[model samples]
Target: MLGIFVLAPILIGTIAYIIRDTWAKPLLFLFQFSYVAFAFSQFLSVKANGPIIWNTGGYTDGLALSLFADSLSIFMVLMTSFIYLAFLIFAVNADYFHSKFYFMFLVLEGLIMGLFLSSDLFNIFVFSEVSTVVVSILIMLNKEKQAIYDGMIYFFVNVIGSSFLLFGAGMIYRTFGLLDIRAVSAAMPMLEEPQAMILPYAMMIVTVSNKTAVMPLFSWLPKAHGTPSAPPVISAVLSGLYIKSGVYLFIRFNQMFAPVIDMQSFFFWVGFFTSVMGVIMALGQRDIKLFLAYSTVSQVGLIVVGLSMGSNVAYWGAVYHIFNHALFKSTLFLTSGLIEKEYKTRNIHEIRGLFRRMPWVGAATAFAVLGITGAPFFNGSISKYMIANGTKDAGITLLLNIINLGTILSYVKYSAMLFGKSREEQPGKPERIAAATAFVLGVISLFTGLFGEFLTEFFFGIELQVDTAEYIKKSLVYVFMLVAGVAFYKGLLKRDRILERIGTTELTFNGIITVMTGYFITILVFLSSVL
Candidate 1:
């Protein structure tokens, strides 16, 4: 059953690719629906029984290929299935839909699912490399203008990251003579020299950081996610779900190496700065997609902060945020795509009267903005509050608030498009499926906020008793931040030349790789010093 979750998609995708007929797409869609149903069943099974483990060739030793599905892995699989299903629906009505596109898309989906489920280190490396190739190809699929250059940069940089992962895996294999994660965990505490694992841990984590788009290594994210030529659905998936794979691995590896390394504080500070820089960069973006792209960097940073806090409450909050971010961010990106189509431009300044012309898209966009900015009744506010509750450090709490303020400011700039008069009425009716998808996601975003505690308990089996009075107090703080964000945007960001320059500046491929190298070296040195 566990193997079916990973292999079925690949098998169907390969068949679709070979067929290359119009019917192939419909067949692929059926397979996607089947997979979602299968994932839901797996989730229930995991809840009722224990974790599911399957070893190929009936070999139980570390050398055999294995798939393990626990609550976390199954939950992630379910989330990916939902998002991919939405993407598939959107693609059905999109100009980019074709047999070839569906084939690659399905292949990528299988690889991602496998990455989440694999129990062996080597299997993870293999899945990551294949997924990297598929994503680069998808990124360059349209081949418009700099698409080739963008794809090459994404490919080369991630290949370098993959090399680091391979080296780290080798180190682990040499140290323990085993490759299974469970086996490594069992062997870790009995090792004579715990400090010997630091180098491998650091190497692997830095590579994961690049995938998660933390700090300097993040240069590739905006380029990949906000590429003008790529399909908007691709951007939505990449920002909303794909990068979470890196985060998931970050958590997994930290658990595996816990006996030898304690780097929670290191990631916490890095995430803090990444959040700060992400929002600052977002403030300068004129393109709506690019603005959302940088905002994702900021959100991922916040998620990292939550996960690194070493508190179970914060860990769950981080997990919930990953889910919430996927919902709201996907809504934003899908709606942005609709707006771009209707307005004939991606510039925030040039686009206006969204409400007057395309009310559905405007309303969906507004809901997403409110959710992301952590408005009192929105989903983001709940997760943000939970994450805040996990920390006792004043400085860390203050930094969280600052990040929240920056978030509000960026979205305030974004919401301007919802107002003002339209230059012309949009021609033709909007795509019904796209509009329906966005609206449904928007509604879920609101409902998740309204019933956050219940949903959290339902999904994660953690009871969260809400303190209404305390929440009301936090709501007041949110209002203050909203007002401050408005003032800051109007008074400073509106006329700031330096910020404009910073936002508009683009880095070349070489410059990006240089930053990644510096990031790797800095993490290595910091870990060496601390250890």
Candidate 2:
């Protein structure tokens, strides 16, 4: 299954490369639609009782090439295909459309499919590296000096993360003498020593954090995400599906190491800190793109907290939010891209009264902002309710309720920049491709939220109650958050304070400190067990 899906895009690109003249564009479009059709078929076939496993090639004792399609994998597959379709449309209409660009895009599409479907640990490492390298090529396509700098930072941070991933995979293989994820998970209890499990678990956390841009490891993400030249879809995929690859591994391994590790406390604290830090940084941003980039970091922290709860509801929350965040966040970024292209500036202060100029884009941005902030009749509300319920059940102390408030506060800042009250009109035209994608996804978000229960059950194979009264209660909390955010912004406006002024030098210092801290902490634990 994985090989077929992964190979499809590569095959198209290779064929396109060969033809290069008459048929390349047609072929690219054909392959894009074909993959989406195939993905939807796979989704329909998957049952919640168990996953569908396909092992086309034999495995060496220490390496396996296999694929599995479960509810989770199906959702990711669908997302990759849908997002790729939008990117393809953008490519067709882009001012500069090169064959090389299409090739890179197709290769990334295939690699992501492989990453999501692979059932082997070593295979995850292989495909993840492929995705990273190919996406780096897209970043360089920005044709700006800052793009290269951002790409370099992206390369440096990801290499550090990849090292951790490989080390952890090696540790697991060394301990169990197997490379397949299902086998390692099943055999985890057979290992007699607790330290063997703890070592790999901690390494896995570092690796996952590096990819997902969790606090302390997220220095590269803002730079990479804010790079001016990359397309909005690329930014969306980078922040959305690609980052979740690490989170997927964490979820898989968390189940295996549940007995040896206390993931709840670790995720809660890291998530709390990241959430606060991300929003604070976003509030101080002059560039709206950077604001959205940091917002991705903060929202990812919320997803992590939900995943760490380790309950069925929390699991549902994490998974569902992954979908919600992808659609809403992408809509926001694409809308921002359109705004920047029209006004010829990324500064929010310079672009005031945009709502009157581009009413359609403004409306789209409003929908996305409300959706991500967990407003009622939106997808965010559904998943957030589940997380709140699970948090109470998990007894996670400190900031459970506070985190919910922060979600609303952060979006309040977002709204001010995106849809401020001043309605000044400017004469201009909108980018057709960008606006189309934004509007389509915005409508999809509203549909998802209105039928939120149906979508949840369809994906997870479990039906949950729709608590109307509790939902109303949650709305009140959001109202409070909005009020607080307005107050904070008013204060900042009056005082002219710096909110996101972590100098590049400061970020570099923090990155160094974080990487070293991760290394020494792992070693200390390993030595403690040995001594």
Candidate 3:
């Protein structure tokens, strides 16, 4: 059953490509629905029973190749299934929704599920490497010069980054004499010294941090995610669902080393600096896709902070936020495609009056904006509230508020397109299916928030009480931040030369590889000193 999650998509995708006819799309949709239903059943089963583990070759759990599905990993698989379907529908009428695209796209889905469910360290590295190649292919699907350059850079940098993971996995296997993460974790208590794992931890954290796009090493994100020639759904998946794999690995890897290590404080700062840098760079983007890409860097920072908080509430909040980000970011990216085509431009300042020209798309964009900005009753607010409530430290709360403020500020620029009069005389006819798919997902962004508590319970199987008074207080703070963000954006961020240069500045491929090596060494040095 676990392998089915990884195998079914690849098989179905191949069948879709081979059909490559009118029947192909119908078959794809039918298979997609079945996948989602099966995923949901697995989620429910994980809740009702316990984890489902499979060992290939009928070997013992610790020694054999392993597939394990618990509450968290299965839920991720289910989330990917749902969004991959939505993305499929979103691209149904697209020019690039041909057989080859579906082949690679569905295969990417399976690879991501493999990342979520695989318990073997070596298998995780294999999945990551393959997914990197698949993503590069998707990026280059446009076959334009820019896409090729960006895709190549993406391929090389990620391949280099993944080597660190391979090394880390080998080191761990050598030290613990186990390849299974569960097996390694269970053996941790017997380890003679914490220092034995520091090198492995540092090596692994480098790959995860690079994949997660934290500061100094985040230069590849806008280039890869905001590639001018890639399909919008590619951007959506990369930003929305695919990047979460790094985050998922971060959680799992930490657990593997948990018995002998604790580095929450170090990572919390890493997340904070990343958050600030993300917002600062985002504020100056003229390209819509680039702006959104930088925003993702910032949002990932927040998720990292929550995960690093060492509080269960904050950790789950980060996980739930991952799901929320998928909804809103996917909606934004999908709608950006529609808006870009209708306006025939990608410049944020050049595009005007989306609300007047494309009412449905504008509405959907507005809903996502509300959700991402953490407006009351939107899904982002609930998770953010939980992250804030994770600690009583006033300074931490203040820093969180500041990050939220920066998020609000960056989005203020994005939301501007939703208002004003169109420069075009007449609007183009809306793509009905695309518009409907994006709109439906946008609406879910709101509904998910309205039922945030219940969804958290069901998705995570944990009942968490939200203090009404505290929530109200946080809502008030959000309102204030909204107002402040608007004022700050209009007053200073609108024309800041420093920010403009920062946003445009990015590392070349060689530079990115250099930074990756430097980051790995820094992590090793830091761990050596502390551990």
**Which candidate tops lDDT?**
3
Which window of ten consecutive residues has the lowest lDDT sum in model 3? 421-430
Backbone clashes, each candidate: 0, 0, 0
Find the candidate with the highest TM-score and give its number. 3
* Lowest summed lDDT window (length 10), candidate 1: 421-430
For candidate 1, lDDT tens digit of each residue in 1-531? 788877888889889888887878788779889888988988989888978888999997566888988888989999999889988887687989876787788888889899899989989999999999999999899987678778888899899988888999999999989999988988999988777887788778877988999987788888888988888888898899889899899889988998778889988988888998898888889999899999999999999999999999899999999999999999998998888888889999888888888888888898999899889888998999899999888988898998898899989899999998779865335688898888888888899999999988877888987689989998999999989888988998878878768887767878877887787788778777876
* Whole-model lDDT, model 1: 0.87
Ranking by lDDT: 3, 1, 2
Model 1 residue 32 CA deviation (Å) reads 2.0
lDDT of 3 by residue, 1-531 (tens): 889999999998999999889999999999999999999999999999999998999999899999999999998999999999999999999999999999999999999999999999899999999999999999999899999999999898888889989998999888878899998999998988889898888889889888889987789889899999899999999999999999999999989888988889988998999999999899879999999999999999999999999899999999999999999999999999998889989898887788888989999999999998899999999999989889999999999988999999899999888877788758666789999999999999999999999999999966878888988988898999999888988898777788888778888788898888888888878888887
TM-score of every prediction relative to native: 0.97, 0.92, 0.99
Model 2 ranges with Cα > 4 A deviation: 58-63, 393-398, 418-424, 492-495, 502-506, 513-531
What C-alpha lDDT, on a 0 to 100 scale, does residue 241 get in candidate 3?
95
